[model samples]
Target: MNRSTVDVTFVVGYLAVAIGLLVARSNPATTYEPSIYTGTPMITWVTFAVALAIAVGMALTCRGREQALGIGLGAITVTGIVSLPVIRNYRFAGMGDALTHLGWTRDIVAGELAPHELFYPAIHSIASVFHYAGGIPIERALLFSMVITFVPFLIFVPLVVRELTGPSMAIGAAAIVSWMVLPINNIATHMGVHTNSNALFLAPVVIFAVFAYLRRRATIERLPLGLSPFSLLVVLSGIGLLLIHPQQMVNIVVLLGAISSVQYIVRRRSDDHPILDHPTMYAHTIVLGVVFGLWALSNERFRDALLILVVGLLTEDVGSGAEVDQRGSSLTEIGGSLGELFVTMFLESAIISLIVGVFVLLVWLGRTRLAPEAKSLVNYLAISMVPLTGMFVVYFVGTPTMAFRQLGFIAVLLTILAGVAISRGVGTLSNYVSRPGGTAIAALGLSICLVLGLMTVFASPMIYDPGQHVTDQKFSGYESGFEHADEDLPHAGMGYDPYRYDHGLNGVEGDGTLSGATVDSGTVDSEAFEDGDYADAYNGIDYYFIMTQYDITRELGVYQELYYSEDTLEEFERSPEANKVISNDEFRMYVVSSTE
Candidate 1:
């Protein structure tokens, strides 16, 4: 078939898959079911399987570089869209960090700054702009924001790989593999903390620009009209990173610092000169760091958080022991088993990519002299793994799951390395055979490997079961309870709303009022309501909005300590002074008459 026909067919197929997934799944407010592939309904699985087959077939059959690139790009687009249905169906505009982000965005759209004591406001500001300018709903604005932040990484992976290794099938392979590989942060599928996700998206672009500058292909020299376009882009990206996410800015700085340090060390050892001796290269780094530091210091909330984190790290008690206890045993107690650690790291790193990355790194290290560009690239990759390794060690000490975010950067780098390794391996194998059939056989073997890798990566969510997604019933209940409270309570006259709960409510003003308040099942202590203490505590609030125990346990498992037991809920329900105003299977609203 002609290239245009092939491209058109892939586009049509991708749209069909996207539509099918959206239609097949029930809305988030309906029922909670296991994921599409993991649960029942034979047709859903069959449709997904067919879509995968088509994507794989097109990618393997493509003959030209352009066709291959199209296939790769199409596959990434389809994968992203397929996951969106689940994200959209999430009850009450997502769960966990997603809900918090949604709340921030809502406040921003309402033209209120400092809505919450949030460190990163760029994502919310961007979403607010989209909501106002595009006249779209908040949900759609948030989803579109996610898409915008995510698409850059998709575009960058292939382009960067092709640029580094030259145009070949390896670029297509790298693109598809990296897109499919499960991110350690789970940011790709689950919409939480858009700042980190956005930072990740911008990472490769910044890296490419830095590399270009080093190669002398781009510089900060001024033209007759103005500053060079390439130089302008690099500076803007650096500033953008500073504003978007602090952690991401730190990650980028560490990455750049590592690269520069390695380059300097290698040059000194080999009697070679620095690639970019101009002051502009260091200027951007210094400006970004200084601006971020000044902003953090000026903001009291950010400064306190930084101090707390620093204290926790220094004390070696950064995270709670609950996570470590959940892991069965502490790494320190076991003396850190290398075999077990390797297995855990491999699973989190996308197994295929990790294996290929290690193999390629070893192969490259064994060789003697190499081209300057190749050597520099190899050294940068090696140094990039250090921070990830440190995070892995921290995971063992405490905060096992949180370490996955650090591993995400490693996964991206490894996927690219894997692609290069596969391409070189296949090319070497093809040289030994005399006929065209040998190349075909090699291609078939690689295709099978790629298909299996994709399947494994896709199945990870089901196998690990992170429980990031919540059922429609529970989410709706929690949302309804909050909405009822907001409707019943007096609107804020000039300042923050009086009614509050432990969690951040989307439309509520001021910070939550349930600070240090504890509840069991659906009830708090009777003394909490006596002698006007409750009213004084909640800014003269008389009504308390509470969620059912089942819903709380299911949806907010991480906040279990904040919930009351069933016995406590029943005890409170029987109290004479507390009158129930609204009651449902999912939530309960009570009014303390004495407080009022």
Candidate 2:
């Protein structure tokens, strides 16, 4: 094959691997796939094969700069949106704020007209309206929202980076950083089924707003497609962010504002006026803030917090424990962590990414010559650090865990900037090298960065194990033949307790005979099923093993009821209202709606 063919093939292969990394966590068995890596073993293999095929296609179709970039982004967008159907079984929006989304649907179905959680009033309220329109289920409506929101990053990130840097750098940077940011492993694994997933949609919109605002103020070219309606678009995006997660929305605004202010400061010092002085900047900011603020007022919590922060009476706490109340953390902490969460997303996931990003950025800074425009870009990036630092200060006052989670967006932006820096570095070095030498040098640098990034993506999935959490209320604990009840508990921060519940025998049962079985060799469908006895007769009843409840509430993560037979189980006539003795293991066991 010719050299061009070889390069194209390599690109295709690399992209395939990238796609695998993106969906590696999706579970196939469940309607809401959750994280494949976290649930069914078969799902991982399926996702791997699918990702590989897509990557190969990307490589084969590689053409000129713009087309190649478009293809790569299009792949992510298509896959992300297509994956929505995977979340079919999700209920109550699937999890966290998703509950609010589902709650919206419930109210609509019942013909009630009110909101649920304060955190996501807008999304929930809008979802209610959609349900009233009468076509999709609550789950489908949220999934649609997720898919629609996911598409822009595919288009906007590359476009923005290209505008700021060059086409080649833009695409490469977009790919690397996106790999870190988009499917934040921890969130996808344990939490995406919850309301937290909806907040992620706002990220791309926020980035797009910055891109549009920057272009409006900085670029001399004719207005982009969204520029004419920039203020409206930004307002909408802001409202979305606010409705989904106000704290995260705050982080985006603060970070963007900080960057703009920095650019303005540096430019003014240099006797220049880049976009900071433009009345349009302030106009966009005010309108966006107002629209979202009005929506936030619907939630009393939001209104109170906003009043406290805006009035200067309350600043959010920074370094409290994992169980520290959400009100303790500032708006900046919530938002900033979303930006920075990529690194510690799940142990080593962020480490490899951070190394690659830092390496690339240093290389670029050392080797590349910065045009005045690039310098301005650098200045803006530097200014972004200010609010990030402020977030750190907030961390000191409240929860360190808050800082940990907020790093997702920051990591992406940082990694992308680093990649751009590397490209510029290569370009700069080329200026000094003879033609042949420059080509060789640039090629070498690109290959190294790409290799490192791919390695990080592939290895990230390994950092977490798929074992279920077992505890007292859920199961009877490790003594009951369930493995990993005590392992990997999130003792320090507000993280998931990766455990599963097993039936335990009772103190509360009147029949006092517990019967159970170990089914399937880890596969409930297989021959590993066997009967066993529990010390307490009431163990035949259904239960839950909540890792967070046990650890945080310090209560039994397992619970069982007394039973005499399958049809006639004994009940405690006056067993007191269920209460968690320990706040950490605050879980309780109850009859399940269904087991299949």
Candidate 3:
């Protein structure tokens, strides 16, 4: 189809999906909670509607389909942002773990005026305003934040590629890239991974800035033009990204700049460094560094990480957090916190990356020969891998905070690469497929591949037998320091990995290693071990709820090690103070009171 036809199709498809999302969410019988609704008929219907719309718009916008596609993406980004506060108000509703934390963060940050407490203060501040202006409940605002976060990539990815490869190739690449699901990339979109939000916004802003810098420099080179607004915009975008999530913005820019610097260095050796000679590039880099540097210095964690990396020259292991141990599985881990990096990438990121890789490889192989520009595109794409590797490292080593959320820029890069690869592959195949009867065969093959893939993906949700609605079942288990409902604990102290127990039915036996310990009232101090103490002493609010879950599995030795020891344990086990043994389908909830 032609451009106009494609635009019409895109708009129409998007509208239909919007209507479906509205209707499904509007349903009185459904709460729109992800856990309860995820595999339900309502969710299925909504997914189908949304996916259909996305597919249509995507197909129509092929070959640098920026305008229509960009709007659709922007709309979603707005929606995610709006959802943030709503999720918070209805925190008890299980939208997902990510949604839960997002909701909590939104409320606490808004109420306490502690956006600074979050890893990415800027994004949270903007989100806070969005929540306040809309008069949305905290829960909904959280959800909205998630929706809006996805917008920039939708617009920026196609635009970036189009600048390099022309509209047709851009469209083809986008279509192919749109489907990949990389590891821990959700840090850009989800509430649970708030730090990623900063990264999400920053990545695109940087790209837009880079593009503008290029334009302004070209103007100066050709016509001795005055300072272009494009360069200003680039600088502003970098500032915005830094304000929102400086740490991620810095990491992303530095990683890319390092590669670019290498290119410049190589050129300098041969006396041919265009990027170095270009004042625009130089200005963009310098300004970005300064702005992002200031932002980084504002946060303790970011400041510490940076100081350790650049000034102190501390080793990665010493500076990293414990989470890094599980970022990716062994298969995908690249560098830094090798063990955890592997877990994070393989378990969380691989799906998206793998799908994109396959399609992009096809495009690359099909091209047969690469153009000089294409070769440059390939270099930039390769440079992106550094940040992607960094993401794996951070996922395992560092906390994925709102400031870190923008790290998903790697997701955008991966998507772009995949798109480029696929377009090239299809271009290559077009030659052989043009023969008599060959087009028909190729079309049939494509159809079969698509159908099979969809079937495989949808199979789990489709065949899942809906059992009796047991939403109110009592999850129970009694442990040492405290008592808890079974629903709270998961196998091996992994706590609840929502990915595994999506429906919340299966009960994993608590290992009691860090769980199932019993604390005697005399062994611990009442003031020290009190629930409020955890919050006061450790900024322990986040860990408080998680510790409560372990009460059911805590045993003598296990529970005794707790700082609060006896008094805290007694408070958990006995009560007129809300301590009681309440049993449910999976586990029992116990109210306890303690006397130190």
- The pairs that clash in candidate 1 are 519-564, 520-564, 520-565, 521-564, 521-565
lDDT scores for all predictions? 0.52, 0.42, 0.43
Write the number of the candidate with greater TM-score, choosing between 1 and 3: 1
Candidate 2 lDDT, 309-383, residue by residue in tens: 444324433234433344334213323332333333343344434544554455347543555565555556556
Give the local distance difference test score of model 2. 0.42
lDDT of 3 by residue, 231-303 (tens): 6676677666665556456655664475466556656685643444434355566767876666666667676
Cα RMSDs, all models: 7.6, 12.7, 11.1
Error of 1 at 291 (Å): 3.1
Listed in order, each prediction's TM-score against the native is: 0.72, 0.58, 0.59
TM-score for candidate 1, please give it. Answer: 0.72
**By summed lDDT, which 10 consecutive residues of candidate 3 come out lowest?**
461-470
List model 1 lDDT by residue over 253-318, tens digit each.
Answer: 666666656655655676543333422444456666676787667777566655665565566656
> Which ranges of candidate 1 are over 4 A from the true structure?
1-12, 15-29, 32-48, 57-69, 76-83, 86-93, 114-118, 185-190, 219-228, 271-281, 316-322, 327-350, 368-372, 391-402, 428-511, 514-596
Clashes of each: 5, 91, 126
